[model samples]
Target: MKAKVFIMIMLFVLFLVGCDSEEEVDRKVQDHIMETYGFEVDITYRESLNEGNMGDRIYQVQRKDDPKVEFTVDLMGMWETKIAGDNYEIQEEAFFIGEKFVKKYENELSKLKISNVVFRKSSGLYIETSYNSTISNFKEETLQPLMEFINLLNSYKESEKFEDNYAELDINYSNDKSVQLTQIHEIKTLGQLKEQLYQDLDISNESLKAKDEELFIELENDLRKLGYQYEYGLNSDDPRFESFGCFQEFYENGECNEGYRMYLKGDSLEKDKIFELIQFLNSHSSLIFQDVIISNSKDERIIFEDIKLIKSMADIDTVYSGVNESLGKTILN
Candidate 1:
């Protein structure tokens, strides 16, 4: 009689387990989060329609009572308890805390490919949060810190700029998003990056600063005529740039010489116009100018990228170029 009762109980347990296989996967996910993240949670699964990861089984897990405390775990191999990554995505998204911050900055954040942010939901305050650039041997790996700085700048609105708490920054980039990048990068005269990169190769008969001032004045009028505006650091009247000399070397040679990051864009600028202006800068320059970044000011993306080729502006059809400091000039293709 005892054996029979034990057998019946075992059979009943098996029957319960066998019923509803989908619910079993849910339990496993919930258990995985609880064991792994120490959060007693429920999950909402989403199907991704993205090209590379089509039909991605994305698990959006929320703390049982608190909805704000949420994160995503990608289940690979169809309920095999496999995860794509545990560290990278969350650490990168560390500053995105709640709905208000996310909603306010959605349009701006989307440019960074950050469409949504949800943090450990709390009654109190908390937050969480790629340089695809390839200049100065700066692979995505070496420039993580710089990328973080750029991310912080673009993630905030004008009024809420300092609301996100970060440690004291050593970056030279401007806090004011409205400020043009040209004005803030450095002060001094820079007609082209090569003049400063190889200071010994000075071809200037006049003060490079004076030349820069003259050149920009002429360029500004022409830019406006072409519906373009200097997006970074070229505000001639701003007092911050009063001391800026165009001929100074701010970065180490060859490793990271950002020669004249003068991004020209306008509210009415179209994609074709970016190429036109870049080509204009390319062929028009008297000095050895490389790494002329033609970008969408609003998006802050390199419309043209550098591929380490060696081509002149006249031959530049698709790629961009930058001086290697050690190797002189290389192009992007």
Candidate 2:
């Protein structure tokens, strides 16, 4: 009878150990990922019994704040990582925004691509970036600590202790010019983050406005040199302007079919003057300058009914006179 009881106790202990072993696998995997990537994760494990034997053990892992970004690891099989949800898609979109932001001020910023950001309790924050063929040229001088601030108000998960956060920036680029960039920032306080985000946006807006003003001045000078008296305005809010490409192929070859209408309050209203303006532009190889309507001070509208016809009518001899004169002077010297 004692032998029978001891056998039963041994079986019970074995059952408990089996259950704990399964749970231990899940915990160890989660802990490994947390330590490797510095992300806090929630993990759950389940085991199935088939034919009176334990089946595959499944582990589900999720980032603390990003439940949608979940992964499943099977300990019985090859232990392959499987991802679910739209986390990759969301991260891709954020990467595109980061790419544009970097390109907008590339001359001032480093040439790097940002991939994604990871926030951690132990290591603070980290950014992940990848390059295709080579590394990026990122520097601390360009990306100030203020630029690393990321607002988590609209994030997948909300945290009460957000202020105990730091940030990491990742920049990736390739020799082929492909880049991905991401920024991970710790949340110190919701209000503080919101305020800092708004402040940064405001500063960026002001800087862009200043750059636009400078470009407008340059454009005005060019137009004035071409004998055009006009008041010009920029339609930056127009969606079409967002993808506008003022290249020769876009205007002449139908590669880019979009058109832009420039509204102007000008002094010139004569047909001859309009023709001269068109001819001059053509001589300067402004082939993409089409679909433009010039309105004068008297509300007179001038349109280039046939851009090709106007281009053909421009005098080649007159257009090349300056070039020929320069060549002649060079020859004489």
Candidate 3:
């Protein structure tokens, strides 16, 4: 009778365990995600630590349908490492979505794109979150931190006016919402600062405060800011001159994809005097001169290159000269 009682108790415990199995919930959630979101993603967790580092919980993911999609998110959670840096220890819970999981939506998922979100986090926050179809609908403000970082990196990467070396911080909030009242820390290198100057120029060149007294002065300032320097052309007396070198070796979206050329002309003792002439011509719409021919002749006859190219002015000059030679004869008319 005691043996029978023990068997019955063991069967009851097994039945209770079966009822709470997460496998059922996982299957249902996966089905709902595929049907509703039109995408497939696989989720996995990882824990890693080197000798000098604290253990980190990394959530890795892949798009089952798309091989090109993959991303990971690391949770520091009270883990601190002075060698690796200590700026990212969250007292609150934190949640990070791996890049692979986010990539499944690609063009179909508007909110999942790097341009759509911004990620910023503070310490001492508790993090608990899961990805679902709802993630594709995150608002612009909610994704500002991540989006801002992505843009910052992207713009820096592509800007020829800036440097390539930059720091990155990927963060997410566990609370499922962005709160303004939080402390977030960020670190960047001096190279990034220089690159930023280049990008800032693309944003608004009017803000650039360099002496345009010489092209070399502006180019040197831009390159020095980007942790770089350059040499000028060997032919100093040539007809054309390269104005500047790229400050940074990168280029970003809406960047200067094409090369721009500015021409210089006029005989002046000072460079500013030449610049004033160019500025005056630019202010006038009627004046369009590509080349200036300094007439060393004593006649002081100004022959515009365009007038010579079209030859109509040449023909007119010939007709006028012939008329002058004829001296108002009725036969010439």
Model 2 residue 291 distance off true place after TM-score fit, in angstroms: 2.9
- By lDDT, the best candidate is 1
- Per-model CA lDDT versus the true structure: 0.43, 0.40, 0.32
Error of model 3, residue 251, in angstroms: 38
TM-score for every candidate vs. truth? 0.26, 0.28, 0.20
lDDT per residue as tens, model 1, 1-333: 999999999987876554435565577667777677666766665554233653356677655764445566666552233555333234324434346566765666555443334333222223333122221221333234344334444344335653434322222212221111222123222222322323321222113434456776777677778777665555555534332232335234322233343555565434355556655665556423434444343554443333133244433432323323332222223
lDDT of 2 by residue, 1-333 (tens): 999999999987876655435455556666666655566666644545342433445555666764334445454432322221213334333434444444444443233333333332224333444423232112223233223323322132234333323344443433323222222344444434333332232223323334344544555566677566433444344423321123233332222233322334457655466666666544533223344455665655554422434443232232223343321111100
- Model 3 Cα shift for residue 261 (angstroms): 62
Q: Compare candidates 1 and 3 on TM-score and give the better one.
A: 1
Which candidate order results from sorting by TM-score in descending order? 2, 1, 3
Model 3 scores worst on lDDT over the 10 consecutive residues at 84-93
TM-score winner: 2
Candidate 2 segments whose C-alpha is farther than 4 A from its true place? 1-111, 115-219, 225-264, 285-288, 311-333
